[model samples]
Target: MPKKLYNIDFYKFIESLDLHSFTVTDVTRYLFETYSKEFDNKKNATQFVYRHLKRLSKEGIISAIQGKSGKAIVFRWCTESSEDSELVHRTEIYGNKTNDLIVSQLQEKIRRYKTEMLMSVGETEAYSEWVQEMPDFAEYVKPHYQNTREQAKLMLGKVKGFERLLAEHEARLS
Candidate 1:
């Protein structure tokens, strides 16, 4: 069974850090390889950063300041708190309404998906094409058919009498 990833208290940890603020990319790489060593799915550094910023902003533990370059949100930790303070209550700077928009979009997608799954396909569409039409599935499988000649040859070699196999397969289909 695959392990479930619980949402982390990313903001609290951000608060714990001594720096005024840091880049999300830098933080995620640190979190993935360093703190969250057990979790290896760190490829979405931007998502991780966005989610953490949203979480932290909701709690008021951190604030997103205009980046040094301008127009970018560089997250900076709060400094007004007393040095001895431990219990911090961070409220969502951006409200559930923002999150609601995302949820509603996802819900709309799920509704569309359920509706789509229940519907029949066009006469010209193959089942593989149907699956590949999905954004996630399409992106996931786009590279699947991208084998180089050498790799294709290697894969072909792995088959037991692939030529004969194809002939038999065609015969069976016929």
Candidate 2:
């Protein structure tokens, strides 16, 4: 799938453009002139603008106005719909660097906790079976098994907390 590029920079760039209608070529030229460092070449920059224009049109962020000849497509920045503007704002917030960092950290913590829980469960089960067959070794193995169980419980608690935090963040975004 094509990577979505509705990032803060893109949002700001689109916002900076004139409200009047513009052709893809006009937008591409403007982008190349204004932010040449962002694109490797004019061709790539033009492609990026084309894709962005199509996406924005689909999202109702911009309206495409067909010209007289039917060959020219002029795009005008659209803000007539409050819902579309709100969606754009929310998208910007979700793509913010701080939110991205928090999301990454939460995902990492959740993954680590899940792995630890699986390992703890495996160890505890092994110890339980070993203790059942060998009662003489129960005293030595029981403590370790108990420790694993406790660790697993703690991990589960942490996982639940992280999940709640993530859900709250998502709710706020929505």
RMSD of each: 21.8, 6.5
**Least accurate stretch of 10 residues (summed lDDT) in model 2?**
3-12
- For each candidate in turn, the TM-score is 0.39, 0.54
What does the lDDT come to for candidate 2?
0.81
Model 1, residue pairs in steric clash = 58-91, 58-92, 59-90, 59-91, 60-90
Local accuracy of candidate 1 as per-residue lDDT tens digits, 114-153? 4443332221144347455765675554454332333444
User: Pairing residues by index, what is the TM-score of model 2?
Assistant: 0.54
Q: Write the per-residue lDDT of candidate 2 for residues 16-111, one digit (tens) a residue.
A: 775478888888888899887767788877788888889878766779999878997998877653556657666775578678798889889999
Span of 10 residues, lowest total lDDT, candidate 1: 116-125
